[model samples]
Each structure stands twice: as structure tokens, then as C-alpha cells.
Target chain A: MLKRTPLFEKHVAAGARMVEFGGWEMPVQYSGIIDEHNAVRQSVGLFDISHMGRLMVRGPQAEEFLQHVVTCDVSAIPLGQSNYGLLCRPDGGIVDDIFIYHLPDEFLVVINASNREKDWQWLHDHTEGFDVEIVSRSDRWAMLAVQGPGAEALLIQAEESGAGSLHDLPFHGVALSSIFGYTALVARTGYTGEDGFELFFDAVHAEEIWDKLVGLGAKPCGLGARDSLRFEPCLALYGHEINDDINPYEARLGWVVKLDKGDFVGREALVAIKAAGPSRRLTGFEMVGKGVARGDYPVHTLDGEPIGVVTTGMPAPSIGRPLGIAYVPTSLSAEGSEFDILIREKPVRARAIKMPFYKPRYKK
Target chain B: MSHNVPAELRYSKSDEWVRVEGDELVIGITDFAQDQLGDIVYLELPKVGQVIAPGEPFGVIESVKASSDLYAPVGGEVVAVNGDLDASQEAINTAPYGAGWLIRVRPSGDEEEGIMDAAGYAAFCEDRAH
Candidate 1:
């Protein structure tokens, strides 16, 4: 049986098309993908991201335990801030990409929904010596993301409903505030290229907050729009971009791997991989041909020899063109490098382009 | 939950609709198909003179989220292609039965053999939806 988020009923009531995603029955689209996607780019949009896994770790060695597990420097993030990082196997292959939020006495790690059980097991297996407690709090909160250019303005309207002013929260900043008479955690972070905030509150209040936000003109976007919105920004999706066999470096996420952060899982292997240089690099490309390239579509040399496969491919709504990401030989990963994407047994022309496919407007 | 199923058109199990104008058959996907596909961005159809076998795929339609094959309801020779869809595939979404017509085909005389009429197709769609 698939799991359903707290807002599942609301989505159904709003006539959203539900699909199975990450083992959860989630809304894939409400209005439509293109309209909802463009709404986030031009105005503001709302999303239900409650299916993500939220795990809490707290103890004297909370920071120490995370340092050993994550690829980034956990100690560098000051209290009330979050940092993007990765968890990798000892072979340097990615386990999961995550967001770590630093609190006063505890650290909250947010992981992909599909990797919730795997990550929890991986974290537990590596915690034989650490004195920290890790607990899954997935059902405790329903997470909502209000993103795009007018996100702040839409959120501020809820101030009369007991929500605190979000005018001062910097990007990647977190704070405990109240929303609709319930205490919640509001963070200035988003997955889209637009400026926005993510709110985590009790599950029971999902409908109230969602309806209130929608009433304020925040378009109710779904997972369909979310995928397109993130695609243009080149935000990595777990199964598509990074996987247990694809290392962070080859996925073009090497910047998040802090090699200087001392001893950590995958650190040694990553050091060796870095010295050897990545054999293949992930790159953004636009279809010079007529068809839209899709995931697992083969990328080939002009002469028809297969080199790599598309990781994420779609018609980028914001870019107003068909674009995608793929792993190609490091020599062919440069901008303007021409290649072909095999769509339905025919190779379509494409050219490597600079990422992100769309420029971001993240607030400082 | 109701779809616009015109009472005069013929339908295929794959959700394509065919309109007979004498020996010529004009075909396009149903409103339900376009609704399910969501935001049609691209359409690829057979050439004007190409032959299509019954139940065979003649083209592909892609939305932002999915790609589906356009299946032929009956064996026919293509007469006309909706060239306007090359520039604006959204026509398939907004005007599915009219401007969104995909191809015109001269049927092989068995176009009505296995296809369903408006009422039967509507029932099929209703059954599948449930």
C-alpha cells in the first residue's frame, strides 16, 4: 500500500491527478505542469512536500556524528542555518543528498522520501560509537513550500492568522514561528530557482494553511510542476542524477563534498577519484533536433557510438525549449559540444549548454 | 468527471476519435486523452502519403510530463497532417476535437469494424476512469 500525505485529501478535493511517487500517492498536477511551472517563475506557487523524510539527531556528539556521515562540514553551519550535503557509500558513490539544519542542541536532517528507510539504516549502521540519538519524525509535520518572486508577499498575508513576519529570514535560515495558532518552523530555503520559504508545521493544520495560502493567490502546484521547476534550475533529483553507483563528482555535485572536513565516509575514495579526475561529467544540453529527450535515452557520438544516457530530460518550461542533463565524456562535457540523443531508435542532434538551464533569483 | 464525448464521432479503445467524411476519416485524440497527457508540447505524425496499419502507432505526442504513442484506429493511407501542431501543440489540449485534428486518412473500408460509437466509447472511458 502506498503512503499518503496529510494533504492528500485536499489535493483530491481540488481535482488533482494523483500518481504513485516515491512510494507515496501524491498529486502530480493540479492545474497543469506548464501553467504551474510558469507560475513559480513569474509569480508565486505553493507545494506540498510533506513526503520528505525528516530525521532528528541530538546529543553531545550530534555535530560529530553528522560530520562522519555527511560529505559537507557540519560544524561550519551556525545555529539557525541549513547546508546542502550528501551521504555516500565507502566507495564514493552517493547514498543520498540531504539538507542539514543546525539547531541549538539538535540537528535536523531532511532526506529524500524514497531513501528514508535506506538512509535511516545507513545512518544507524555507521553510528556504533557515536553517542547521539536518531529518530524518524516523518509524520510529525506537513511541509509546505511557497516559492517564486512574490512568495514573501503571499506569506506575509498570513500574519493576521498568527503567522510571524518572514521579512528578515535570510536564505538558508530557519526559525520557529507560529502559523494558524500552531507553532511551526519556517525556513528561508527552496528547491526552485526563485526566492521562497519552506514551512514545517503539524499535520493537522495542512488543510487550513494550504487553503489560506491558496486563497491568497499562491498557485497550488504539484509534483509535476515541481519536477519541471527544478529541472530548469538543474537541481539534482536523487534517482535521476545521483544514485548508489553514481558518485557526486560525476554528477556535477562535487562542490558539496568538503574533502577538507576531516575523516568521513567516502572521503578517501573521493580524494582518489578527484585526483584521477572524473572520467565522465554531467552536463546540461538543449535538443537541436525536434523531439524531447527523456530519461535513459542514449547519448551517442555523431557516428552512433553510445557514450552516456540522459539523467533528466524534458521541455524546460522557463527556457521555452527542450533541454536535459546527461553524463558524457569529460572531453565532450564542455559547452557547445555537439552530440546526439537517441529518441525511439533515432539520434537527435543536441548541444551541451551551461547550467543552470535557467538563472536563479535566490535571495541572499 | 464528465468528458466531452461528441455523440456523432467514432472512437477507438486507445482513446482516439475518428470522424468520417465519406471515404475519408479524420482522427484526433479524445478530450480525455489530452487531459490525461497534460500540456501537449510536441506532436510527431506520419507523412502525408505514409501507410498506417490498424492499431499501429503512427506518431507520438509529448507533454511536459509524459510521452504517448498515437495509435491508428484503422488501416489507412494518410492524406493530410495537422501541420499547425508543429508550431502550437497546445491546440490538442484546448481544441481537441476541432483544430487539434491530427491526420486525415483514406480508410481501407474497415474503419468502422472494431471502433466504438460515441455512446460505447463514453462507457469505455467511464469504466476505465473508475
Candidate 2:
């Protein structure tokens, strides 16, 4: 049996297409994938990201414990700031990519829903000596993301309890603001390439806040749009772009690894891996001939020799073209490199292209 | 939601509709099939004069969400192909019966081996609606 988010009732009432995702019954689309996708790119869209695992790290050695496990430098971030990081194994394989926010009394960590139990076990096993408390708030809190080019404009109209301007908040900044008569954690962070705010609040107020946002011309988007929205920005989706066998170097996520920060879980193995140079890299390509390259499809060189597997592939709604992200040999991970994606046993022509298929519309 | 299964035509279990026009037969995905495959973006149609085996996949149809093989409902030779779908395929979602008709075929063998009328096809669809 699959679990459901707090807004499950509201989603059903809206006639959404519900599907099982990450062990949860989630909406795959409402109006449609293309419609919701265009909403995020053109105006603003809202998403029920409550399926993400929400964890809290408190106690005296909270900062030290986080620094020791994550690849990013947690000590560098001040209160009310968030940093994107990754949890890796001792062998430098990615466990899961995460976003950690430095709060006043505790640090909030957001992780993938499917990896919630495994992540908890990994984090718990590592806290043998540190005086830190790992608390789970997965069920008590609900997360909503309002993203797009006009995100700020749409969110600025929301009922607020703060006196300062939201535009003043820096990217990756966090604030405790009163919304809908309750204090909610509003973070200037998101997975989509657009400028957006992630609102974390009590699960009971899920429908109230979601309704208000949707009533304010914010399109209700689902996981389908979420996946496509992140793709145009080249954002990595765990289990797709990165896995237990893929490292930061090969996944084009080396920027999140702060090897000089301190002694971390994967620091030693990452140093060795970086020194040895990556054998293959995640490369982007566009279909030069025909057919959409689906996931797990074999990619081959022009000579028809199988090379690697496609991680994510589809017709990008924003770019209006069929694009794909795949792991290719180091020799083939170059611009203008030619390859073939076997779509239903037929070799279709493709060529390596620059990533972020469409130019990201991020606020400066 | 109920699907639109024309009473005048026949349907296959794979959700393809066949319209008998004198001697030639018109083929296209049914409304249920198009609804199942939302927002089609690309389509690979069998060429004119190509041979189609009964119940065998003859071409490919893909939406933004997923893809599926277009299995022939009857054993025949492709007489015409909808070339317009190669450039724009949204008609499959908007008009699965008219403009979205995929191919026209000249029958070669028994065409009623596994096909069903509108009433039988509607009940067949009802049984699969979980």
C-alpha cells in the first residue's frame, strides 16, 4: 500500500491523475504535463513537495556532525542560509543529494523520499560519538514550492506577518514568516531552475495554503512537471543521474564537494578518484534523427558499439526538442560527438550538445 | 470517464480502431488508447505499401509521458499513411478518430479473428478499467 501526502484529498478533488511514486500516491498531472510545465516557465506554478523527507539535526554538536557527513562545508553557512550538498559512501559513491539549511537552533535537512529510511540509517550509524540529535519530521511538516520567472511576484502577494521585503532575502536564504495565520519556514531555494520559494509549515494547513496559491493564478503542478522543470536546468535526480555507483566527478556535481572543508565521509575516496581522473562523464545529447530517447536505453558510438545507458530522456517541453542526459565514455563526452540511441532496437542518430538544453532563467 | 467507441467500427484489444471503407480499412488508435498516451509528440508510421502482420507492432507512437508500439489490428498492406502526424501529432489527443487516423490498409486475410464490434469493445474496455 502506498502512503499519501496531507493534500491527497485536495488533489483527488481537483481530478488529478494519481500515480504511485516513491512509495507514495502522488499526482502525476493535473491539467496536463505540458500545460503545467509551461506554467512554470512562463508565469508561476505551485507543487506539493511534501513527499520529500524532512529531518532536523539539533544538539550542541549539530554543526560538527553535519560537516563530518556531508560533502559541503556546513560550518561556512551562517544562520538562515542553506547549501546544496551530497551524502556519499566511503568509496565516493553518491548516497543522495540534499539541501541543508542553517537555522537558529537546529539544522534542517531535506532528502529524497525513497531514500528516507536508508538515509536515516546511514545518518544514525554515523552518529556514534557526536552529541547530536537526528529528529524525523517527515509526517508533521508539508513542503510547497512556488517556482518560475514570476515566482517572486506571485509570492509577494501572499499574506505575510513580516515587515521586511522578501526581495531583500538572498538566494538560499531562510526566514520564519507568518503565513495564513501560522509561522512557516520560507526558504529561497528550489530544484527547478526558476527563482522560487519553498514553504515548509504544519501539515494541517496544507490545503489552506495550497488553495490560496492556486487561487492567486498559481498553476497547480505535479511531479511530471517537476521532473521536466528540473531537466532543462540540468539538475540531478537521484536514482536517475546519480546513484550508489555514480560519483560527483562523473555526475557533473563536483562543485558541491568541498574536499578542503575537513574530514568527511567520502573525502579520502573522492581525493583518490579525482586524482585518478574520471573514466566517464555525464553528457547531454539531442536527437539528430528521430524518436525520443527513453531511460535505460542503450547508447552507442557511430560504429554501433554500445557505450552507456541513458539516464533521463524526453522531449523537453520548454526547449521544444528531444534531448537526453546519458553517461558516455570520456572520449565521447565532448561537444558535437556523434552517437546512436537504440530506440526499440533501431539505432537513431544523436549528437552530444551543451547541457541545460534551454538557458536557465535564474534571478541574479 | 467513458471512452468514445464508434458503433460503426471495430476495435482490437490493443485499443486500435478499424473502419471498413468498402475494400480498404482505416486504422487509428482508439480514444481510450490516445487518452492513455497523453500529449503525443512523435510518431513513426509504416510506409505506404508496407506489409502489416496481424496483431504485430507495425509502427511506434509516443507521448510526452510514455511510448507504445502501434500493433496492426488486421493483416494487410499499408495503402496510405497520415503524413501530417510526422510534423504534428497533437491530433491524436484531440481527434483520435478523424485527423489522427494512422494508416489505411488493403486486407489480405481474415480481419475478424480477434476484432470486436463497438458493444463488445466497450465491454472489453470496461473490464480493464481498474
List lDDT for all candidates, in order. 0.91, 0.90
Candidate 1 residues B96-122, lDDT tens each? 999999999999865535699999988
The iRMS of model 1 comes to 0.5
Per-residue CA lDDT of model 1 for A279-315, tens digit only, reads 9999999988899999999999999999999999988
User: For every candidate structure, what is the RMSD over all alpha carbons to the true structure, in angstroms?
Assistant: 1.6, 1.5
My TM-score estimates for the predictions, one after another, are 0.97, 0.97
Note the DockQ of each predicted structure: 0.85, 0.67
Q: What share of the true interface contacts does candidate 1 keep?
A: 0.78
Off by over 4 Å in 1: A160-164, B110-113
lDDT of 1 at B15: 88
Error of 1 at A299 (Å): 1.6
Best by lDDT: 1
